[model samples]
Each structure stands twice: as C-alpha cells, then as structure tokens.
Target: MAARIDEEITFRKLEILLAFLEAGSLARAADALGVSAVSVHRALHSLETGTRCSLFRLEGRNLQPNDAAHALADVAREVLQTMAQGIRSTREIAGYAADRIRIGSLYSLTSGTVPALIMALRLRKPDIQTELVLGSNSELLRKLRDGELDATIMGQPEGTPDIESQLLFEDEIFFAAPAGSPYAAQSAIDLAQCSDERFVSLNEGYVTHDRFRDAFRVAGFEPNVVMTTNDIFSLMNLVGGSIGCTLLPGRIRSVLPRSVCLVPLLPAFQMRQKISVSFLRTRERDPNLLSLLAACRSHAAERPLASG
Candidate 1:
C-alpha cells in the first residue's frame, strides 16, 4: 500500500523545517509560528523519520540542525517557490486573472452599490485592479455563468443551482415619472391604474423588466410598452423628457435626472430586488470573491437598508 499522508513528507513539514532553521530553537520556532513547541518538535522529527536521515543533533540541552537539515532547507525553499509560481502561472493561463478582478453589474447600481463594494474591497487588497462591465441583469448573469466575469453584482438569481449569492442589500422597485408628467404628483402609484399609459421599459433581458412584466400580470393588464431600450441612462432620459413612464430601482435615486422622480408603489403592487454579490458555485472559495463577499457583508452593515 502507498504511504499514508501523515507518513509522507509534505509541504507543511517543509515550512515547519524552514521556520525551525531560521528561529534556531523549538520554543522560538513555536512562538514564531504561533504553534505549540511540541508541534514544532513533532514536525521536525516526523520529517527526519520520512527521510530516514539524521536531521538534528542534541548539543547539551538544545537541539541543533545537522548537515541533512540544512541541505533539505535549501531544497524546501526552492520547491515552495517553484510550486507557488507554477500555481500562479496555471491560474493565469486558465483566465483566472489573479491580479485583476472582472466585475459585471447592472447600470443602476453604479451610483452606489458597486462603488461601495469596490472601495471596501480595496481596504483588504490595495494592489488589486478591477474592470467593470455594466449591463442588464440577464447579460451580467450570463457572463458570470460563462466564466467571462470573476463575479457580478446584480439581483439575486432565482433558483440558480450553479450559482452562489450573498445579499448585499435590498432595493425597492418604484414607479418612475418625470416631474411634470401627469402622474408625478401622486404620493403612491398602483400598476393596475396605469394600464393605458405609454411605458418605455428596459429591454427583455433585465431583471427590472422581469419585475415589470410580473407586476403588470398581477394587475390584470398587459402594459402598453411602447418602446424598449437596453440602456438605463436612455430609459431615464426618456422618463426625464416626459416621453414615457417606467419602473426603476431606488438605488439610482441620487443619480436620477433632475426632473424625474421615483414614486413608491402602493402595498398591493410593491416589489423589491435583493442586490447581491453573485458568483459561480465553483468559485465560492476564490480569494478575490471571498474578499468581495466580505466587502458585501461590511457594506450591508453600514447602510440603513430596507427592512423586511
């Protein structure tokens, strides 16, 4: 039978060996590594047993490294360096982009959510670079699933088994109308009452569009969607121009056109989206994603989020 993992020399054993050599004493090594002295002693003894070589000598009460130990230390340093380089090279070749994080997000989140996430992430990883790709929910999620993005910030995927999501915050979906539009003065709007209005919504692939269709369905009417655009800016422009009305999220309220307004939907037509840091289930433990997820949790804690 092959030797068990405990019986074989390992990377951890090599690291302990190097630590002991530099620290010069088992107690010192233990302190340096934040481990028990017994553990440091055992790792060295275990490594010596695996090699069947005399790696240490007892000089009075102190244990000192022998020729074999010094020789192995040299080899261990090179082995660790080469292995680390190889792993980094492999990750790069496979499009992992270790030094750069590729992010995809909905345009509406740019004003607040995405910027906060990236800023918080920088506190942990100052040298890391980020590339942002903005699109509708569907396009961003597709890029995430295809491995074209390292992670994405968007509405949580519904029943997506292959993806993992960590909720950052919840945002209300509201009725958007220009200031001078006929319906802008209303304190609250109900979707059912606006069936005859000309609506210009985002194109078919956005999460907001999904909510748009669902809300109208519950209201017992097909929306008179007279125009559709893929750009949130253009959609907002159309609304600001009073060309048509549409639904939008509350996160972009600060950036809404000076003449446009976001009116809350009445209780009966109210809907909310859970904005999250989403990634592939396979990348749940990726370092960059782990940092981003941490940033999401931190960001959520700082905000006076919408309550359930």
Candidate 2:
C-alpha cells in the first residue's frame, strides 16, 4: 500500500504556528494573521497533532514550544518562501499574470507602436512586470494560440477565429528602394515596371514578406529576391546600402534610413495590413489582457489607421 499522505499539515496551520511562535502569545498570533485568539489556538493545536510529534509541552497552565517547535518554525518559513517562488515560476511559464505579463509583437511594430503601447500599459498597471517577445506575424499567432504569450500586437493574422483581437490600426505596404533611385520621383510605381528589380526580403513567416509575395503575385510576376533575412531591420539596411529593393509597411517610415525611400505601390498591388492586439478569446476577461486592450484602444484613438 502507498504510504498515507499527511492531510492535517497545511499552509494555514504552518502560518499560524510561525505566528504563534514569534508572537509569544495566542492573542498576538491571532492579531498577526487577523484572526481571533481562539482560531490561532485551535490551528496551533491542530498543527501539533498533525506533526505526530511532541512540539509543545504543557507547563502548569500554558503550553510552551519545545525545541522541535522552534526547528519546525524555521522549516515552515522556508517552505512558505519556496512555495511562493514555485508559484511565481509556474505562472511565468504559463505567461499568466503573477509576476510578469508576456506580450508578443511583430518586428515592424518595435519602432513605434509597441513602445507606445508598453508605456500606456505601464501607466495602467504600474506594479505588473512585462516581458516582450518579438517575431513575425505567423510566429506570434502560434505562440498566442499555444499559451506562451499573454497578448500579441501585430498585423492581424488571417483565419484565426479563436483569437480575440482589438484593431489598433491599418498600414499600407510601400515599395522601398535606394534614396537615389529614380522610383523616388514617381507619384506611384507599377510593380510591372520594376519586374527586373533585384529585391531583398524578410523570411516567409513575416507579414511583410507574405504581403510582398501577394503583391507581386497580383502584379503577375515573381520578384527576383536576391536575399532573404529573418528580420526586417537587416532587410531595411540592405535597402539603404542599395543591395536591392524591398517592400516595407508604412508604420516603419519613422525608422527608415535616410538613404532609403518608401514609394506608393500602384492601386492593383496595394495591400493594407490591419494591426491589432490579439489574445485567446477565453482570456478576454483577464486583467492583463483587458488592460492591454484598453491601451491599444487609447493608442488607436490618438493615431488612427492611415487612409489609402
């Protein structure tokens, strides 16, 4: 037979035991835990009974803590502290709101949108700690679905009906090129005219990369991408160095290098990216998610999605 687990020993009793030992009297112990003296007395009595060992001695009219009681009190403090740490660790792993709130975002938003929203979140939840995970739209959506993230701010993903999202803004994709490129002088450039242009693009999962493919497909030809990178920043740097042309979101305009120019795509090739804060539909009522939604709504109010 399996050994019987001790059910009598519990956190409440241990807490009372610690208080009773340190406070020197039942009344003081009760006051420490905001309970009545009788409750403290009963809890200590139960704890001693549960230990199955002599932890107190009857001295005339009062019970005095024995050496064992003192030692057990130390253990009790350690147990409480260790349990507290364990709880925090579990919550962090689950990305639940305990000590930290984990947020996911697309690399494109890092320049401005993500930063502004984080500041807004801090104002509403000053005590809550934040952890940010940046990745592509596909990657962030996967993480959010898998419970690894508390919320995500990105170009709203497609076909993910399970996610609850708050629309923050909409952004248009722009054709990017070297600042000195002749395309900079045009009011709009047809992708067909740049069919021979060498391009540097972000990897497959990025919203920008996916949108690039869609836009090129609409233009009725495949882009001659000379290079592909996992990040948007490097792709932009390549554009700045004239390595090749690329596509970028309008939101990225604030951080684009002076050596690069973002030009409008002709009507046929234009794709609007709807940026949003997404979380599990079930987690809509979570305090952290609610705060995040409020922050996004506030951001949307101050900076509406650009009109094409």
RMSD of model 1, in Å? Answer: 4.6
- Candidate 2 residue lDDT tens string, 95-116: 6566568999988788788889
The 0-to-1 C-alpha lDDT of every candidate, in the order given, reads: 0.87, 0.87
* Tens digits of lDDT, candidate 1, 1-308: 97664455999889999999999999999999999999999999999888988999999999999989999999999999999999899886544648889999998888778888999999989988999999888888899878789898988899999999988888888999988876788999978889789889998888888888878888899888878999888899999887789988887888888889889888888888888889998887778888888998999998866722
Q: Please identify model 2 stretches exceeding 4 Å from their true place.
A: 1-93
Q: Assess candidate 2 and give its lDDT.
A: 0.87
User: Which portions of model 1 miss their true places by more than 4 Å?
Assistant: 1-81, 93-97
Listed in order, each prediction's TM-score against the native is 0.75, 0.72
